[model samples]
Target chain A: MEAIILQILNGLDKGSAYALIALGLTLIFGTLGVVNFAHGALFMIGAFCAVTLQRLLNLSHEVIDDTKKDFLGNPLKVDVPYLADWFGADAAQTIIQWSVPLAILFSIPIMILVGISMERGLIKHFYKRPHADQILVTFGLAIVLQEIIKAFFGANPIPTPAPPAFTGSFDFGALIGMENIIYPYWRMVYFAFAMVVIAGVFAFLQFTTFGMVVRAGMADRETVGMLGINIDRRFTIMFAIAACVAGLAGVMYTPINSPNYHMGMDFLVISFVVVVVGGMGSLPGAVLAGFVLGILEAFASMNEVIDIVPGINQIIIYLVAIIVLLTRPRGLMGRKGVMEE
Target chain B: MLGLATKDFVLLLVVAVLCLFAPVLLNPFPETSDLAQFNAGYPDLMQRFVIFGIFAIGFNILFGLTGYLSFGHAAFLGVGSYSVVWMFKLLNYNIVPGLLLSLVVSGLFALAIGYVSLRRSGIYFSILTLAFAQMSFALAYSVLTPITNGETGLQVYGNDPQYLQGDSAPNIPHLFGMTMRATETVEFGPWLWQFNAGYYFCAVVMLIAFYLAIRIFRSPFGMMLRAVKSNQQRMRYTGLNPRPYTLAAFVISGMYAGLAGGLMASMDPLAGAERMQWTASGEVVLMTILGGTGTLIGPVLGAGLIKYLENILSKINDNILHQWFAFMPDGLEDFLVAIVHPFIGKGWHLTLGLVFMAVVIFLPGGLVEGGQRIGRLFGRKKPAEAEAKAAAKTPAE
Candidate 1:
């Protein structure tokens, strides 16, 4: 039982990422009626935002520390970050340590700007095009985005560490009178962060007039236009929001998995599977599917399970996707006439 | 002339001429020239061009004619490669059996994948194919280690059984006794041109594949496939089952992909899991779309252009850029190199991506259409009307 719980816990962080990305993808699909393949690139850009912040915080200058002399010499040269000069050394140290979290704020504006520009400049033209063209064009965008990222950051995975405070694991085994049920504090934080964001998005959509209009627009774009509502503009904003959400997921994800240029692509196929399994254009379904698949993948990877099935973990999600797609073509919660054409 | 319409026959002849003389044509620069880096007349790269040409051509048959965007096409390519390599491991080093085996294996594989995936249309079909591909890749990488040789990839080892091995047989892949890597270089003036056995063989195969594609494009069955693409529901309303036609196209394309894969292994005796990755599948899609999705020669052109660019652009590092701009002022030269930096060397994908996006956006018809548009600008007649005239005179030709 403890082992099972531990597995579920292990799954949550990855699940949270899938849910976040799929939620964004579903939003773009539901509102704009566009299949945004570059959504994964948006997540990657978000992770780089964290990397960017760390780089910014660590921008340094060489200073001569007369107090600390080198073996050969007059004065030891010390590299001092500009942050240490602006805010004292202790504050600068803390800020650099917490740069990944701080990147959340940094990436939001950048992600929104990117989303807005992407929708306005490129995807807007493809709205009336076939889904194939949309897919191809967005796929092109994804490649360009990742290539640009690769050009800037180089090909290596940049390890973005969590704050010193959350480095250790939280023991849950002792609480339940069990052994070895400990979980990482950062992972738990990730799950909580995901829940908060998911709730925030739901609440924003549920309680606000803007959300209601967007939802109605998704239901009937023509009807919404007849009502004199500028559905297109709202959909564009929604695209930005979705991009922002994906970006946040990436920003938080860096500590869990090192932020590589191809990380977005690595997650992309799995996330697409998540969205398909959840049901295209279904927000709640996307989230639910994400968590379920993540946990299942965790279970599938277990040594006991692998002994029986042999390499089931590597393909369990795809297997489930195939089975689900064959059985339930509309997905777990897809609406009618969404992508039938 | 091989039952082709006069216009298509002319196009076929032109393609044949290009393929036949590629070694000479591609070696436009002298060996001693600074532009030597741009030459793709070598065996390995030329093989890739033709192999990928065959791949894109096969892809075009499905995606171009049927409008089925299969995202897992590389699965067949990988399967073909594995079959060929296995043949090498078990049988003789001759490529004949391996290539034939590849086509058969990939065809069967495609049939099975298509049977299930064709049940859904649009995005679902694509996702299904992708899922199946990822599964195969995973299996090949891990569980199928005995067959696939896992991460190290399947290769001929000293201990491996070679039932058809003989004292006279060459160890490398061959067509009977003629090794695939056999090359003859001729120097005329300062230019050096290579005539490679493998490239010529692959080029011959590509030409045959191209001719067959042309035949398929003009046939009544091809029209039916096009009709299916335009409106499957309408075909169904006409009391026609489009499934068999689609499944047939899928399998045909799969065989073509497998054939390409087989040729790849024939050129170089190694097959790895990466061959089945979605990115490899995406490359064929990129080639087909970038060339011209529905056109006869678009995929070939796209494949050649991409492969050439990959070979040439990747060699243009910062130093090369600096050298090219050396005649300018120091600051200007440095600035130019910096500006050109991101689109060359390791950054060629960025340029390719941007070009792909532009092609999809402004010129959806691809490079073939782009060529037609340029031709139209300088012509006395529109090609569409000329095509009608040619069709009228087709019986005589």
Candidate 2:
């Protein structure tokens, strides 16, 4: 029982990420009707936003301290961050330590601009084009985006840490009257953050007039367009929101898996699977399927499962995908006629 | 001549001549010149150009005609390679049995995958194929380890049966007794040309593949494929089943990819799981698109161009860039090198990405159409009439 709980816990963080990215993919597909293959690249750019901010905070000049002496008996030199000089030293230390969370605020505007520009500049022209053309063009865009990132940050994974307060594992086992249930505080924080963002997106879409219009547009785009609503601009906003969701997912994800140039591509294939399994253009389905697949993946990786299947862990998701795709063509909760053609 | 219409026969003849004289034509530079680095006439590379040309050509048959953009074609390529290497392990180093076995194996694999994947169209189809390919890759690295040899890759082991081995047989991959790596170099007045046995073998196979592709393109079945691409529903409404034609195209293309894989192992008898990766599949797609999807000769040209760029552009390090711009002052030279550095060396992918996006954006019909446009632009002597004639000659699609 404890082992099962541990496995579920293990699955939550990864599942959260898949859910977040899949939600964004579904949102864009729902609103714009353009399959954004480069959405993964947007997730990647958000991770780099954290990396960029950390680098910005760490920018420093050399300082010589007369009080400290080196082995040569001369005044010792220290590197003082520009942040430390502006804010107090302790405050700057705290800020740098919390750069990952602070990056959430920093990434939002940047992600919005990227989202708007991507939809307007490139995807706007591809509306009437065939889905194959959209896929090919967006795929090309993804490669270009990843290559540009690789040029800037090199190919290595950069480890970004959580805030100092949330760095250690908390005793979940003790709290729940179960031993061996310790989990990282950061992971719990990430899961909570994901839930909050997903809820926020859902609530926004469910409650507001903007959301209503977008939903209407999604159902029958022509009717909404005929009603004098600038459905195109609302859809653009919807694209931006979706990009923001993917961006926030990336920002929080840096602490769990270090940001790398190819991290986007790595998650992309899995997230695509998630979206398909959830049923394209279905938001609730995306979340449920994401968590479900993630948990399934976790269970597959367990020693007991591996013992039975030999290498089930390596291919469980794809196996599930192939089975689902073959058996249920519309996916778990796909709308009628959506992507049917 | 071989049942081809006049224009196609002319195209075939031109390709035959080009293949026959490739070693001479590709090696434009003298042996000792600094420009020798740009020459792609070497056996290793020339073999790749033809092999990948075959890959893209087969891919074009399905993608160009049926408009099914498969993302997992490389899986079949990998399967073909494994089959060949297995044949090499059991039989002698003869490529004939292996090649034939590879074709059969990959065709079966494609039939299975295509039957399932063809139920869906557009993005779903692509994802399904990608999932299948990734699964194959993972399986090759794991459960298929016994057959694929896992991370170390599949290769010939001494303890293998080799039941057909004879005393006169060459140890390396060979056709009866002619070794694949055999290169006869001819040097004359500061110039050297290589005539490789393997290249000629691959060139012959490619010509055959090209001929087969052209015949298929002109056949009634090819017309049906085009109809499927243009409007599958309409065709179905006309009381014809599109599934069999599509499945056939998929299997044929799969056989093409498999043949390419077999030839690769024939050139160098090693098969790795990496051959089935998404990137490998993407490379074939890129070649098909960058050349021209529907046109017969486009994929070959694209494959050669991409391979050339990958080889030559990646070879240019900062020092070469500095040397090229040494005529400028120090700062300017340094700046030039710095500017050129990222797009070469380890940064070749960036250049490729930019070029790929540019092609997808501007040249939807690929290099063939681009060439036609350029030719029309230059031939200002009654451009309208010539343009109309050129348009008439192009496919009806």
Candidate 3:
């Protein structure tokens, strides 16, 4: 029972990432009718935003300390961060410590701008083109974006630590009347964060008049346009919103896995599998499948399962995707005629 | 000539001449020239050009004709390589049997994948194929390590069973007694050219593959495949089954990829799981689109262009950039070199991405359309009519 609960907990964090990325992907596909291959690149840009903020806060100038000798027997050149000089050492240190959370604010505007420009500049022209062309163009865009990141950052994963307050594990065994059921605090925080974000997105779409019109537009764009609604403008805003969600997910995920240039690509194909399994344009299904597959993957990775079938964990998600696709052609919640042909 | 149309005969002859004298044609620079680094006439690169040309040509047959965008074709290539390596391990060092086995194995693999994937059309089909390929790649990297040799790749050893081998059996892959790596260099004046046995062997195979692709393009079966691409519903209403034709095209292309893979293994005698990655599959797709999808010879051109760029452009470092801009003023030279530095060498992918985007957006017919447009610009024909014709020819969907 404890193992099951632990596996579920383990699955939740990975599922959160998959859900967030798939949400963005489905949103773009739902609203703009585009398969944005560069969506992963946007998520990558979000993680880098946190890295950028962290680096910015830690911008240091050299200070010679006569008390400490260097390795070469000279006076030690202790680097004092500019933030420490300006805001006093304690406050600047605290701010730098909380850079990951702070990056949410930093990434929002940047991600929106990127989303808007991507929609306006390159993807706008491709709206009428074939899906193949869209995929090709966006794939090209993805390569360019990833290569640009690689050039700037080099190809290494930069570790970004979480705040000291959330570094350790929480012993849930005592509360649950079970032994050794400890879970990491940051992972629980991530799960809570994901829940809030998912709920917020659903509430926004359900409650707002703007969202109602957008939903109507998704169902029938031409009819909504005939009723004189500016659906295109709303859809573009939705695209930006989707980009924000993906960016926020990336920002928060840096503490879990160190941010790297190719990290987006690592997530991209799997997220694509998640999207397909969830049914092409179904948002709820995307979230549902994400968690389900995540748990399935966790279970598959267990020693017992590996003993039964070696290397099942490496291919479990894809195997599930294939089986699901073959059996359920429209996916779990997909509407007919959306990419059915 | 050879029962082909006049245009096709001329094209074949041109291609033949080009392949036969590629060493001389590809190496225009003198032996000691500074531009020698740019020459791609060496055996390794030349072999790659034809091998990848074969791969791309096969991909074009399926994608250009059917408009079914497969993202798992490289799996077949990997399968071919693995099968050939196994043949080399178990049998003698002869390439013929290994190549044949590669075709059979990959063809069977393709048949299985295509049968299932072809059930769904459009993007779903693409996803299905991608899943299969990813699964295959994962297996090859992990549990199948006994067969695939995992990250180190599958290679031959001295103790491996070679039942057909004699006392003097060559360790390297060969056709009869001739080694695949055998090369002869000839010098004319200041120019030097290398003639490689492996390259010629691959070039001949590439020509044959190209010829088969041309025949397929002109055949009635090809027309049926195109019809399926244009409108499957209409074809179904006309009482024609599109599945068989599509499956056949898929298998044929898979065999071609397998052949290319076998050739690759024959040249290097190793098989790595990385060859089956989706990125490698994307490379072939990029080659086809960049070269011009539907046109004959376009895929080969695309393959050669990409391979040449990959080999030559990647060798240009910061020093090379600085050297090129040394004639400028100090500040200007530094600025120019710095600006040009990132998009070369390690940053070649960025340049390639930008080029690919430009091709897809501006010239949907790829380089062929661009060339046609330029040709029309020089001629007396009105540009508007030519533009319309070109637009009409392109399958927009």
- Model 1 in CAPRI terms: which quality? high
Q: List candidate 2 stretches off by more than 4 Å.
A: B380-397
Query: Which scores higher on DockQ, 2 or 3?
Result: 3
In candidate 3, position B189 carries an lDDT of: 97
Clashes of each: 0, 0, 0
Q: Candidate 1, residues A1-341: lDDT per residue as tens digits?
A: 98799999988889999999999999999998898889899999999999999999999999999999989978999999999999999999999999999999999999999999999999999989988899999999999999999999999999999999999999979888899999999999999999999999999999999999999999999999999999899999999999999999999999998999999988888999999999999999999999999999999988999999999999999999999999998889888888865
lDDT to native, each model:
0.92, 0.90, 0.90
Cα TM-score per model: 0.97, 0.97, 0.97
DockQ list for all candidates? 0.86, 0.77, 0.88
Fnat computed for model 2: 0.74
lDDT of 3 by residue, A57-130 (tens): 89999999899997899999899999988999999999999999999899999999999989988888887888
Selected candidate, larger DockQ, 1 vs 3 = 3
| Candidate 2 pairs with clashing backbones | none
Which regions of candidate 1 deviate over 4 angstroms? B381-397
Off by more than 4 A, model 3: A66-75, B380-397
Q: What is the C-alpha RMSD of each candidate to the true structure, in Å?
A: 2.6, 2.1, 2.5
Q: For residues B1-397, what per-residue lDDT tens digits would candidate 3 score against the true structure?
A: 6766666666776788999999999999897988888888889999999999999999998999999999999999999999999999999889999999999999999999999999988888888888899999999999999999999999999899888987786779998878999999998999889999999999999999988887888788989989989999999999999999999999999999999999999999999999999999999999999888877777888899999999888999988878878888999999988888889998999999999999998988787777677766777655334432333344333
